[model samples]
Target: DAGVTQSPTHLIKTRGQQVTLRCSPKSGHDTVSWYQQALGQGPQFIFQYYEEEERQRGNFPDRFSGHQFPNYSSELNVNALLLGDSALYLCASSDLGTGGWAYGYTFGSGTRLTVV
Candidate 1:
């Protein structure tokens, strides 16, 4: 895991683009979390990987997996890429080891994935 490192700060139009992202926990953080932000909505929690294993998950399919931190990138797989999947995917990291995981989260930029 190299943390959440998003590329193409702009938008990535998709006509069948590889809908897979990457992420990892921060250096001191042991929990890697992922989020999905639609065009006009707040980021939604997808899942979290802690201790190299998935610990918690949200109302998302198996495709949404990864972490977000100052620098991170996880993998979110959307088998059936839908137009609704087109949104900003973000990665975040938290210090779950110190019991301050949900409170303090560091988020990196976002990768705008457009499904067309």
Candidate 2:
């Protein structure tokens, strides 16, 4: 009955450094997705994973990468971090092919990354 979980609730990194965020999906979930939300802005899709493969991606740079594990856990990695990269990184999990209002994704509290 646990929801999605993200590690390292907060992080600080210097510009040009790299960072990795971790996530564990909700029970019975198979798909995992990542999003970035800046202050005063809504969440922006980063990418999605299904069957341990990336199924979809948004307009993020190549520096952004992700991986999904067999157990439905996932990881998000950012390289050459910039000040603009500072934001709340969210991980959402849901069952694929179960699209509808009643089967919405469950999101984690998110990892706050600050690039100084």
Candidate 3:
């Protein structure tokens, strides 16, 4: 019954560099979603993965990509990062498919990325 966990609670990077963040989904969950939350803004859906395939994605650039493994964990990779990429990267977990409100999406505290 573990909750979602993200690695490197805080991170600092420079412009034009690449960074990868890891996430472990809650137990008994097969779906993982990534979100980017800027200061004082609601989380913006970056992408969602189910069955190891991307089911939906938002209007992010190609630089934002992700992968979901067999164990339902995930990793988000950003290449050629920019200052604008500095934000709270969140990883949420849910059951396969969507239906109930309670089991929809449970978000982690997130990995704070700071690009200078």
Candidate 4:
């Protein structure tokens, strides 16, 4: 399988607006991760809802939030958008049973968000 999928291939929003993005994990993967990629740079971690209450996050502010459902799918929400928020939103899935990223994450092309 592709491992992950994201919606709204491209998005445009005004500053201060809110946005919600969706993701579906790869089969048998119980962990979902989100990342933000800016121009000419690698993706920056946003957050991850893993097995149990083990949650990992990056330096993002409260404006970013995420959730993982029983089905292992997830949603990423961003509030009070800023021009700096414009970038590619990436989703990755991994099987923690075999040591999460130890097995490498399967990622999608990502959703492009442009905050005006």
Best by lDDT: 2
**Candidate 1 vs candidate 4, TM-score winner:** 4
Which scores better on TM-score, 1 or 2? 2
Q: Estimate the TM-score of every prediction.
A: 0.75, 0.95, 0.94, 0.94
Segments of candidate 1 deviating more than 4 angstroms? 1-4, 8-18, 63-73
Return model 2's CA RMSD, one decimal: 1.4
lDDT of 4 by residue, 19-66 (tens): 999998889999988999999999999998885333898999999988
* Order of candidate numbers by lDDT, starting with the best: 2, 3, 4, 1
The sequence of per-residue lDDT tens digits that candidate 2 reaches over residues 18-110 is 999999999988999999999999999999999999999999999999999999999999999999999999999998857712588899999
Flag regions of model 3 displaced more than 4 Å: 97-102
Q: What is the C-alpha lDDT profile of model 1 across 1-116, one tens digit per residue?
A: 54445555555556545566655545666566778899779999887876556778899875454433333335556655777788888878777757756487877687777778
Q: State which candidate, 1 or 2, has the greater lDDT.
A: 2
Worst 10 residues of 3 by lDDT: 96-105
lDDT of 3 by residue, 1-116 (tens): 77999998999999999999999998878888999999899999999888888999999999999999999899999999999999999999988745522657887889999999
In model 3, what are the clashing residue pairs, if there are any? none
Write down the RMSD of all candidates, one decimal each.
Answer: 4.2, 1.4, 1.5, 1.3
Q: Choose 3 or 4, whichever is better by lDDT.
A: 3
Error of 4 at 80 (Å): 0.4
Order the candidate numbers by TM-score, best to worst: 2, 4, 3, 1
